[model samples]
Target chain A: MEWDWDFAWSIMPTLLAGFRITLIATFLGAIVAAVLGLVFAILRRSSNRWLSRGTSFVVEFIRGTPLLVQLYFIFYVLPDLGLRLPALMAGVIGMGLHYATYAAEVYRGGIESVPRGQWEAARATNLTTRQTWLHVILPQAVPPMIPAMANYLLAMFKETPLLSAITVLELMNQAKSVANSSYRYVEPMTLVGVMFLIVSLLSVIALRWLERRYGRVSQ
Target chain B: MGDWAGYLTLILQGAWVTVKLTLMGSALALVVAFLAGLGRISHHAPIRWLSTAYIEFFRGTSIFVQLFWIYFVLPMTGAELTPMQAGVMALGLNVGAYGAEVVRGAILAVPRGQHEACIAVNLTRWQRLRHVILPQALPLMLPTFCNNAIELLKATSVVSLISLSDMTFQAQVVRSQTGSTLMPFVTILVLYFAMSSAISFGMRRIERRVTRGLDGVR
Candidate 1:
């Protein structure tokens, strides 16, 4: 049918509430991705060949597959193995794990960009490996990573719509239910698109700011 | 293992559909990328504005929403598309928007001196683009284009929601039939990885061929 302004107004609150969940999932997922990515990057850099190769394989597997299927596997297949997660948790983890591969690559690049002299200097001072990583490496490497990491944060935010596939009450899912019951596809769906566009545009501006502020670190 | 042989056949059929969608969608994305990319750099104001709007609209929204809008909403407006049609369109258009930026960046990355050289030779704008610009820009574009293609392939998995019977959809079917979520899911996951690795490998070869004899510039 035709678009209706009043109908749109009536559904605004529900969609906004769904928007909150979408944002929360994205926020939590970004945190998970950042932390896990660091873990993966470090493990991949380990001197132990098996540990590094296994980490690399896992990262490539996650990177190669679709997030939607990963969510399915996490939500559905995990239960078969006696590990159950709430739908939102599964979605968040899946998003995080899927994007973590990309983040790991970013971290690897940042970590590698740290000059060999710095690593040598860390050893030259007789600093422990942990101390060297904590005091010298991460502090220098992490700033340059902020912009790239922020870009993934925004990317993950856009991808929150995929959470709807696992029955998460995110914006897209809310819009679908609204359209299903109300028989008005135009307004809810269009509004969902608009909501995503606005948030993404704002994130782009913020990412540009981040790049300007932190991108000079590696150089 | 013997029982899985039958399920494997079904999944392979589904993989075929996924392959078709990826191929068709990527071809469409490549065409749109060039058109919109060139349009973005065009001297005409309206062309540039239209291209920017198109790119922004597609890039800003999620591909899942785009697919649903085309699959669910479009039919209400009296235009009906088969699930496959909607899936391919959404994947192509969505990825094409991102590819356009890659195209624009690559073209812009061409050295200023090349453009100046074309101007000095009194080459027409079209000739400058055809003979001087794209050849240089193409090598740069290939790497990112490969990434975009893999992204589009992953995106086709979402079409399973619309009942497109791609690999993901077939996995769901196998899951329901055998009540074995792990097997079906793992099977499809491996299939996806294999497909993506193949794309990556092929693209690398193409990139090498394209960049041949241009190593110094790149």
Candidate 2:
């Protein structure tokens, strides 16, 4: 019932191990979100009406649903349909796809902020569509996006706790297991909360630096 | 396939609970948002610091950990709470922190001329805030508040972990009873989307009414 420093020190190793897994899942998930979000943004802007509308609908549907349920579906239901992924893989993908919808909105804003003249200039230079996107548009668009993208990365990190639901040994799961076995809820749970708070505050500082370095997207 | 009506009825009952939690959580969040937001801009330094600390603490931690700490740890300290109470507190406080920022931003966005006019008219601080400031800022807060409400709804799904028998929990129950994983999840997903869209639609209507004359400047 009281604060126990010795007990907290005893569980430090296990919690740190769980913290590593949490970091790994978040890192990989950010990569997946960044790439897939770009795809969603580009697809929604396609010339074909069906493609654009369908892409937007899918993005909205994903955005609307809860990521916890999505993770349950991916980890439990998909295996029934002959797709079985490792628990970590399922967790990372669920986090990535859920956040991709948000990141897509950020990317759309960044891409749109590039002036119409840039597209015209690319065409004037006789560049192909692919060349224009690669050489001219994205370079200008991606820099301003770094700060917003980093914000989602930190959000995804905070969400890693949900991975515990699907049996990934992330920080929350580790803390829960420690509490369950040792019958000491206070230290483990408090440690988990403090660890998360520290990391998130640090990331906010880093995000501010990123915004200053890369320049923020004007909303 | 078996007893389709029974399954639908059970899920609807759970959906009702989800709706209740969302409504209760949002009401609590709105209260916290206003208090903290106003506190952040207060002239008193201690009040401002305390508000900033509350906002940062809630915003910095994951909602899951907060829920666990409230549900599990509090009982140990002899402050027991029902699952519903715990879920509402966690959801409200978490989203309320984010909403406080929105409230602060909207208040700051109100034109300086309005505040000057209040000073010229010799309005007290309370009068200035109630009659002059809030009416203008309320319109700007509506759209962002709608988003926060939807986020709170999505977050209610996390309460299923604590055996609250909410929509997501009932979906899990349905999955076990019917041996069908996909249908229950898909159904709940659609239900969540409908709820979110409904909130957006209702907020837009309110937004239009509130901003009826203000659109000229905004």
Candidate 3:
């Protein structure tokens, strides 16, 4: 029960190795979420009713379910359907896909914050839709969303532990393996908790800086 | 089809466990949310600091780590918790940390006029909070509380890691038994979505009923 410094020291390398994978998963997953979320947001706003509605339903369904279950489906079931993926890849994709729905909402909120006059002005200037979006709208819409998007980044970072459920050898999984072998739960579990706490606190500090710099979207 | 029905029944039993965990976890979370939330704004410095620390510590760590620590580490200290108890405690404390912020924000959002009116009427602090502040704040908290409850529901799936026979865990059982990976996972996903949608729908109804006569409020 007592804290074992020696044992903790020995396991540090393994845990850190796992932490590296965690960071990589989180980084790749964030990219996927950011791009796909933008796509979903845009699709939901499309003039075609079916496309908009379908995208909306997809977002809702994804948002409603647990990431753990999604990860399970990807890791365990997909191979049966002839689309087998490595555990890390599946975890990253599952993480990205689940969080994309949340990120889509953030994107939608930012896009909506753009003024109606801005759109009309784009049309008035005879700017092509692509030029209007690329030059005028997104430039305005995206900056204010940085802070909110970063919040999800931290959320996704914390959720990286769930990636362990799919056997991705992330920090939680690494810690569990150590615990199972050594029969010393206190050290590994405590270290893992501390590691997450330190990163989360630092991320929160960074989030505050982001909020200050970006000036959050008003309401 | 008969065997499929049996699998469905087993998963539904697991779904019942999931519902129980959600309800119990949410109940504990509500209490923790109010106490820690109000504590964050307390007159006493130590109480405020304690509340802030509790909120931050719980919020800063992921729930999965917290659950594992409670289930595995705590037993070393001689306080062994059943898997169900650990799940409820971890989910409650984790979501409660988030809910505390919601509680604090909603309470703060109450108009200054209400507090001034309480003072003018010479209402004691307890009376002011009970009658004036909380009544107005409750409606504001409900929407976010609904979201947090759904978060709690999703979080219960993490308990399956600790060997709790919740829906996600049961899906694994079904998968192993039936050798149909797709059906078990797909079934649970639908069940989870249904539960979350129900939570949202129920919360909206409660919100409507609460805000009925409070025009210009909420």
Residues B159-213 of candidate 3: C-alpha lDDT, one tens digit per residue: 9998999999999999988788989999999999999999999999999998887
- How well is each residue in B59-153 modelled by candidate 2, as lDDT tens digits? 99989999999999999989999999999999999999999999999999999999999999999999999998998999989988998998899
Candidate closest to the true structure, highest DockQ: 3
Stronger candidate by TM-score (1 vs 2) = 2
iRMS of every model, one decimal? Answer: 0.9, 0.7, 0.7
| Superior by TM-score: candidate 2 or candidate 3 | 3
lDDT of 1 by residue, A1-219 (tens): 778899999999999999999989998998889889989998999999999999999999998999999999999999999999999999989999998898998899899888999999999999998999999999998889889888878788989998998999999899999989988889999999999999888888887899899874321
Q: How well does candidate 1 match the true structure in TM-score terms?
A: 0.96
Best by TM-score: 3
Fnat of the models, one by one? 0.88, 0.82, 0.90
Error of 3 at A44 (Å): 0.6
lDDT (Cα, tens digit) per residue for candidate 2, span A17-52: 999999999999998898899899989999999999
Candidate 2, which segments miss by more than 4 Å at Cα? Answer: none
Q: TM-score of chain A for each candidate?
A: 0.95, 0.96, 0.97
What are the candidates' individual DockQ scores? 0.84, 0.86, 0.90
How far in Å is the alpha carbon of B185 misplaced in model 1?
Answer: 0.9
Ranking of predictions according to DockQ? 3, 2, 1
Q: Model 3: runs farther than 4 Å from truth?
A: B216-218
Candidates 1 and 3, the one with greater lDDT: 3
